[model samples]
Target: MPASTSIARARTDAADRLVAADEPLLGLQLRCGGDLPGVIAIPALREAVGKARMLGLKLARPIIAQDGGDSVTAWVEIDPRDDGCLIEFRHWRAKPLPAEDEGHVARRKLAAERQIAELHARLDARQNVLYAAAETAELAELAARMDAGRGRPWTDFVTIPGSAHQQPLHWRLLDGAPVAVAGSDRPWRATLVPVGLPGAEPAGFELYLGSDFPAPQQAEPSPVAEQIRARMIGREVAPVLRQPIARIIANAETIRSRLAGPLSEEYSGYAADIATAGQHLLALIDDLTDLEVVEADDFTTAPDRIDLAEVARQAAGILGVKSRERGIRIDAPKEGEALPAVAEFRRVLQVLLNLVGNALGYAPEGSQIWIRLEQDGPMARVIVADQGPGLDPAQHDKVFEKFERLGRSGDGGSGLGLYISRRLARAMGGNLTVESAPGQGARFILTVPAADPAGH
Candidate 1:
């Protein structure tokens, strides 16, 4: 057989061992952790060759493989012979992997950790609790204890294994340690990540609590009833689907940002589009899940005394970077301002986030958004106002209706946010209302019962 500079050839035995190969193919085989006369190591090509040989057929396809820090792509034609398979490679190309930004990697890791964490806490430099949140009912008591003991070391509320020192151990020593929490039987692991300059004394810490196993589920129900409950999209399907969709978004982002490797501008733009679409799908899934919950007859909120001003500030902080990216400013309530109200803390935060996030999306670049707090006769109120295209009186009422976008499209909104938000407000004995005229901007106001002055 004659060899051409444009095409590379290789041969495999009946047992799928790479018996021979040309320059780049041979070099790639070894670079991908394969031996000279050993089995194929490139997963996609190996599978294609295996199928071609087994079926005694010829196959052509494009395959991609990673070689060291570069990505290799090629079109390969596999022909099955009597005793082996012949491999021909065409248009082989390799591109060096891109350099990833350290800050981006750190941010991605932090986001992943937060996604899996059941409980989260912010700690001061001395490890005193600044704030805490628990996602599960089982951890409610622990969160409450931490909230009540705000200035105390977080370790005081849980039992750490192997050490009985009176003082909390250094963050490095406590990170990834196992712990036991009160009012819960499941074993848990703790993660403590320091904040501030790389080599300087830490400014604060972020604490995360996770468990290898889920909390025990309720006793088994009748088969028919179980089947019906399992069909609930929110309770049964959403959790299973969220992880894979999130991965799709993350991978698309890596490609769009060229963090994995260098890509042509056209391909990079395609990746950007993919990431945007994935985000839209993820948002729709979330809205559907919330819709199911808020529409259920048994839905209710765990009302508690909460600070509306603090919630407003937290929502603003969460969206601050996004606002800055769009050249918009968020004027949140001052640190000293406090508006106590009786509502579910998490629900209020969710509603406020939706309002602020919507404002950021529609508000003109370089404009300002305001989160203001006020107290009526017996209700505590918070208003999110933005300088965007305002709604007319007719559209104001329709905005909160289910799946109502008011003739808008391509904005990546599901139109379920306001509806779900209104439902949640009503569940908490609160009301969400909008005040706006067609070109004067818009204000979304939420009001809930005020906390009793007597501490009732």
Candidate 2:
């Protein structure tokens, strides 16, 4: 190879600290904010060195790093030794970073903020809290306080940095301000997005509370605690995995939507595929968490009197847009058509959602879905009927089995929905069953004890 592409040598100590390097490599390291005899600052290089050391292997690969306004690419060979690793930079190239689009930057920033936010709120024009939600127990107290203080400016609940003039600063002023919440030790950032036409007086705002750091983990656990942690999927594992997966989806969406700048159709499609897969993973995680709950020996539901018709309408309404996108229409029970039942309201709603959602997924374009209510003896029932490829009698039972997909692929389903839905129904003193013949569409019926009119 020519001198321009000649190898530049570097070595690290047993501690994995960069101990020595030749000219261009040394200069690049310093430019990347690292010092001689210091830890590798380039993330790609550090990872390669660590892998080589851990496996006691020799490897060659190309790595990219950013230095100021330029992107640096290099081909390096790593050889592990007793002390550390020897790194040979065989190829070195640098190119100026591409110009950034303002709109792209704004969209990326917004997506990132939404992904990291643990708390969210809807506020009126004057910044008064209308609704609030939190994902973790750490913010449960704050969310409760915000809910209780509805109609009051959200600023009353948290302290903003570098602002002492007064409470409830203008929306523009607090759009990206840092804040300190009562229960969280980590500093938080607030994002306020106005809800109105551009350049017009705002109607309301969407508030997101995000932190730069992950939630602090508890001190190291013993063997028993480790076992407990393993079992606490919903409480522990789900929350930890959600943020990163969400961020991955957000970034992929930004790229797929071209909000991050122009890209070839093939690359954009790849991004779309990535976003879809990420969404499937997220759904699977949620399903697994619910599976853990419904399968628990002590699992129970809070039964109450609820209107099956009302719940059916709600499920239809929630999935209205999705159905429309697929050219499917839902014929939900009309208002005032009530079939009162004794069951857990949310659990029943969940079952209906799964049924309706499944119908939407399988139903042919331009097909119709029907959500009807009926009184069967002492039981009240809601049936979700869809015009789709129906299931055989044998398959009907198999469909509700755990993780059963019936040979379908690429549909992004976890195959746990019906299983969990049935478990939820039984836990709520109800039963979920399906009826269909191949090529004749399908109907899913959910039945619960009829509520006593006198008691209701």
> In terms of TM-score, which candidate is strongest?
1
Give the C-alpha miss distance for residue 272 in model 2, angstroms.
1.5
lDDT of 2 by residue, 79-150 (tens): 999999999997687777566667655755576677668888877678988667665555656877887788
Q: What is the clash tally of candidate 2?
A: 0
The candidate 2 region of ten consecutive residues with least summed lDDT is: 221-230
Residues 405-427, candidate 1: write the lDDT tens digits: 87879988899999999999999
* Residue 25, model 1: Cα distance from true site in angstroms: 2.8
lDDT at position 112, candidate 1: 47
What do the candidate models score in CA lDDT, each in turn? 0.79, 0.80
Model 2 Cα displacement at 130 (Å)? 14
Error of 1 at 374 (Å): 2.8
